[model samples]
Target chain A: MVNMLSIKNLHAGIEEKNILKGLDLTINPGEVHAIMGPNGAGKSTLGYVLSGRDGYEVTEGEATLNGQDLLDMEIEERAVAGLFLAFQYPVEIPGVSNMVFMKESVNAARIARGQEEYTAGEFLKLAKEACKQVQLPLDFLKRGVNEGFSGGEKKRNEIMQMILLQPSICFLDETDSGLDVDALKTVADGVNSQRSPERSFVVVTHYQRLLDYIKPDFVHILADGKIIKSGDASLALKIENEGYGFLGLNYVEEKA
Target chain B: MSQWLEDVIAHAEQPASNELAATWLAEQRNSSLKKLKEQKWPTRRTEAWANTSLVSVESRNAKPTPANITSWDKPAIPGLDSIDIYFVGGQLKTDLSTFTLPEGLSIYTLQDEKAEAVAASRFAQIKPERHIFGLINDAIANSGVVIDVAENAIIDTPIRLIHLANDGVENHSRVLVNVAKHAKVTIIEHGVGEEDSVNTSMSEFDVADNATLYHYRFALFTQKALHVGGCHFQVGASSYINSTIVAFGSDLSKLNIDVNYTGEHSNVDINAMYLLAEGEAFDLQSTIEHAVPNGTSNEKVHGIIGDRARANFGGRIHIHRDAQKTLAQLNNRNLLLSRRALINTKPELEIYADDVRCAHGATIAEIDDESLYYLLTRGIPRSQALIMLNFGFIQELINDIEIDPIRAWLTDMLSTRFKSMEVS
Candidate 1:
């Protein structure tokens, strides 16, 4: 079976320091992969580098989605090629409405894919349905994008975008960080609803609590810019039970 | 002295063909002529005109536009149903006999006998004396309008004053308005021109005690047209004035606005926007004075400079010693879309009252890369995302407009203008 995402020896950094040094990962179709790490483990850096964010330099490595060379495309081109990054701290665009923004993004992706663009009525229908699934009020569609949204609401908004765009592979960059128990379950349920044979997910988090709801098929421990260990769901249970000290490493909580 | 000044003086010295000026107007013109003679032409040393040039107004050939040429098209605001008054080439085109006057509302030409008292009271009264173009306008502007609203009257329909400039003509236009006590009215000053011409359009308003005035001024000119104008207002006790000013830069366009709060408990709010493209230039200066206690004034100015265009904004708020408990604020923000585009912004606050609250800020910025990246990650193309972001910046001010049709008209008009601008 073909891999949905493949990253080999990914050595990327921002400004002079290398954060993702010699990292490798593979994600198969329909599989859920949870990345667990302590502070400064390059988890978020991996997501940013894969999404082609500016200032993130891939010094030595190859990353591809399906058969396309993701590194060769522009940021929006990479997005059009079915790569999505759910920002940990979503940006607030005070004047651009959420509904209008999603419609533009959806039609932009569709135009690049040589597919038919969604009409206003059709897009409105889909947007309303997505808002319902996230349990957000429909009036949020008319409000500014992420403007004045609370932490949980921002995370849910990211999922709403995911539902509307329907990208092939998604990287949730600490999306569960600020969410409460109820919000985490709502977010996990949104992700679970989109799981299919043609879709894959990379969930990055600092805590093991979120793993209980999402139930990742595979778990990996990343430390010091590389993956140090890989196992099944039980590995997450072990880390939760015994912290990072069993691996002979100091467990420093990330500073805000 | 510049040759343009010499020629303008010569033109002002020549008597009008039918010189039957009223006693008050004649005295005002003579004083204005004396001031013009003593004032030196503005050079780079002039603080108020430091970043603007008068070459476009200087080099134009002077030609008097023919009388009553009403062939020009008038822009209509859909669903507004305003009472339109047209002035083409500094001449009134609307015939007074064509429509009946709404009750308690009166419109008259400056030369009409019925407008004598208003013209005498407000001809050159409120505008500052330092403006050379305004002085020239006072000396020779024979075409103007006077509008009066009676006490305790509420005018439903807006009064529109449309001025159109013709090629090679030196058009000097003027307007004076009086809103009586407890009355309410809306006025729109619409100016549009596209020619190798120069125009100075000045207007003044007196909002009386407990009255309300909603005002808008649109300066729509580009290419070879040149415009220098002023809008002045005097707020009475407990009165309110809400004004919006929009401009599209011409070869050289300069506008000055002055608002004075003469009575206590009066309030004034102003929002001004300028959009410049290509080699166009726009210079805007506004001053709000809180002269009495418990008066408040707020001014917000924003601009977009694209291509090789240039924009300048100067905002001043003054709280006098007697104006205790005054609240005044001024904010100016600009966006430069190209490396060659230029913006100069200066916001000033002068307060002599110890109990007053006054603050001013100015900022010039480029497109934010983080916001751009955020949009790109959502699959929107770079160009489309830019238009969205740029328009979003100005939409904040547009949303403040209370009139639905005018707001919608401006949204459509400005979006087209914004799209045509070159952003690097």
Candidate 2:
């Protein structure tokens, strides 16, 4: 079967410096892949390069989503083609309400896919359900997009958006950071609930605490811009206990 | 001064047999005419008119269109039951005798016998003498109306003042509104014209003690029309006044909004929004005076300038010595959609009272790249995302409008404007 996401010899960086050097990974449909990395390991750069974010230069790489070239499309076009990136720091749009923003986003994606757009009532119903799934209040839908939202709330809002958009491939960039025990579980549950045979997840995290809630089918240790080791879920527990000291690698403590 | 000013003076000096010229306004007009003569026309060197030019108003040679010759399309506010008064070509086109007003409410032309007494105290008094066009308006404005709301009366139906002018016409319009003690009323001043025309539209509102006033001023002229107007309010003690202003730029358009706190414990909220595109220009000057103790005022001015359009805003808050407990805040924020677009913003606070709380801030910014990318990442097209982000900056104030119909109408109009500005 064709992989859900295939990245081969991916060498990318922001601006002049190269970060990802010959990084290779493949995610099959319905599989959960956890990428464990230290600071400056180029884990997040992979997501940015695939999403076609401006300034993220793909120096040498071949990244595809379901056999389609992801690097050649616009950021919005990639999003419409079932690519979702849950930002580590979501931006705040002060005047655009969350509901209106999501409506436009979802409708745009639907139209690009040749599907009928959701009516106002239909969109609201879907949004409310997604809001509830992530433990966000319904009123958050009425507030400005992530305006004045707490760190945990913003993370949950991203999950809420992912739930509503229903993209095929999701890249969770350090989503487990800055979240409390309760919020981490809420986010993990939100992600786990969406797991299906047709959807894939690439969860990038520094700590293994989140892996306890959402089990990963495979775990890879990314160090020095490349994945040096790959194992099953047990490898995450070993890192939690050993802290990368056995591999002669330095482990940067998670940020508070 | 250009020949336009000279011609206006000559026209004001010419004798007329109109019934309005025979009223007490005649004396006030003569005094204003004297001031207009003494006052030098504003130039780029003038402080108040620094960023705005009077070239269009000074060069236009549009003859006043004959009254009753032009057809006026009255604007409607969806779901708003309002008593409409139409003014076309500087003349009252609405037949007031056809509709009965609400209880304790009165509306009449300035030529009516009751206006002589009203004009004596309010003709040109509320508006400051600093504006040369105001003086010109006082001298040449012959078509006007006076509105009165009795004490303790609550007028549910809004009074809409609609002004329209044909192309190549010079129209001067005026309105005076008096809300007595303990009364409440809603007044909307709506003007629309986009021709090679000149309009000096002015209105003065006197809100008495313990009263409430909801006011809206929509300056919807664009292209070749030259509009110079002012809305002045004297807020009484223990009263509440909420005023909202929405304006689009024209060949030359300027608006002055002055709120004077005449009584203690009064509150005034002034929210102004302007959108200018192409070669349009809009100048907005708002001043709030706290002359008494325990008064509060808030002013929020937001604008979007696109293409080569230019916008200027001057917000001044003055607290007097006796206003020990005054609280005032003014914030002006602008967004320039193009590198060629320009915005000149100045926020000033003059406080003599040491114990008062006052703050002012102004900011001119471009569309945030992070915010734009955030929206784009959500699968919204670049153009749609651009509009969403642009309109987001103005939606805060539009959401503050208490009138639903007005808010909806403004949102639709501004969205259309944003789409045009972005697509081009």
Candidate 3:
């Protein structure tokens, strides 16, 4: 059987310097993987490449989903192709309403899938239901998208879109970084409700605390542009207790 | 098109009448016509005409036929069917009109002999040096609808003037409005024509003491046409005048809206929107002369230019030396969808008085790419996403409209136009 997502010998960089060198990973549909690494290990660069962001050129290798090429699609096309990236720093757009943007986006996705667009009532119902699960107020949707929103609110709103789109492969990149305890729990609870046997997620972070709530089925240590170790949930606590220093030899050499 | 254009051009200068008018008025008009003949018709070479040069009427190579018929009846906008007079193609179409106006509200055509005082103060008082069309109007104007709202009489119903012309034709029409002291009224003038017609005309409005008026115009015509119109307003003391213009018709058009805020504590609000596509052009020239103290004025114009079309806005605010504590603002913004599209804007504020609040700003740019990507990531198609963002740019000013029908009609038409122009 084919792996749901495969990244093999993936090397990428930001201007003149290589960030992800000879990275390799593969995951099936029923897996939740956590990628923990030290500073400057290309964790964010990997996220940027996967999301089709500009300026992060993929130098070599394939990052594919379901045997289809991912790098060649437009950013929006990549989004419509069952992919989601919860930004580390969400973008704010004034004057564009949150509700109108979401409805238009949902309809766009539906139209691409050869389905009918949602009416005003149908969109309201879907958006309301999503807001309930995420614990966000409906009125927040009426204001401009992310204008003047708190840091925590911006992250929650990103997850709100994730829930609304229901992408098969969701990448929550540093979602819990700026969030407080309550916002984190609400966001985590929202994510937990979205898990399914046919869906998979890659949660990228520097710390392992988020794994306490997400409970990744697999933990992979990514350091120096490559995965050096793999283990179960306990590997996260091992990094939490030992600070990624005692994860073994490759990590020590990486530090040096 | 020229044949149809000549028919209208012939109407541009009303035949000089032989009737014995009071000497002062007749000489006023004669001298004004002489002034029209003295100066050449403004061309693309003049400062005011640099961006919106007036193309000659003879370019059509044919005379107007006076019979450019149409297939579509003007769609029914709320409160439009109740107008006092209905004119199409410079000819009154009485059968299409239905109304039972209040006691003091009535319409009179210029052909009627009752226009003695009106023909004097309005026609003779017009500034002949600014535009050539007004002079042509003075020389050839045959008739216009005159609405009179008496003092202490509040007209609950709006008076609408609908001007419709045919394809490949030049349409010259005129209208005069009189709002008496202490009276309240609203006037909506819409100029619509086929995509292939040419339209040019001027209108004069007067508001008396303690009177209030809401004046509006919509340029929803064909893209193959050219339209130029002018509006001159003399506002009285302690009165209010609000003007809103939506220019979307014609391939090339220029609109001149000026208000002489001559009254103390008088208020004026002017707002406009233009949507351009292809080789189409939208031009606006405005002047607000503050002749008295304690007057307030607000002006805002928004434009969205697509394809290779161009939009130019020229505005000037003039305050007299004695006019103190005046408040005025002018803002203009443009959205260019194509790299080749252009928007030329100039906002001028000339203050001769002290203790005034006046400011102006102009911007030309493409839609925000970050905003575009953000919306697209949410599943909104590229086209719908653009419409949503574009509407937000003008929503605040659109909300500034108090009359419900004008606002709704503008919104609906703009949405449809936006979708039709959707970038493929």
Using TM-score as the measure, the top candidate is 2
Runs in model 3 deviating more than 4 A are A1-27, A37-81, A103-139, A180-183, A220-231, A234-256, B1-29, B55-80, B84-89, B95-100, B124-129, B194-196, B249-251, B403-405, B420-424
Model 2 TM-score (2 dp):
0.86
Q: For each candidate, give the interface RMSD after superposing the true interface residues on Cα.
A: 0.7, 0.9, 1.9
Ranking 1 against 3 by lDDT, winner:
1
Pairs in steric clash, model 2: none
What tens-digit string does per-residue lDDT give for candidate 2 at A1-256? 8888999999888769888999999999999999997787888888788888888898897999998998889999999999999999999998789999999999999999899999999999999999999999899999999999999999999999999999999999999989999999999999999999999999999888999998999999998889999999999999998988776797665343
TM-scores (chain A) of the candidates: 0.97, 0.97, 0.94
Q: Top model by lDDT, which number? A: 2
- Candidate 1 segments exceeding 4 Å error: A1-28, A33-46, A55-74, A77-81, A92-156, A176-186, A204-256, B17-24, B59-70, B381-384, B387-393
Q: In what order do the candidates fall by DockQ, top score first?
A: 2, 1, 3
Candidate 3 second chain TM: 0.89
> How many pairs of residues collide in model 1?
0
Better of 1 and 2 by TM-score: 2
DockQ of 2: 0.67
Ranking 1 against 3 by TM-score, winner? 3
Ranking by TM-score: 2, 3, 1
Error of 1 at B149 (Å): 2.5
lDDT of 2 at A84: 95
For candidate 2, give the docking quality class from DockQ.
medium
**Per-residue lDDT of candidate 1, residues B76-113 (tens digit):** 88878899988777687788668787899998886777
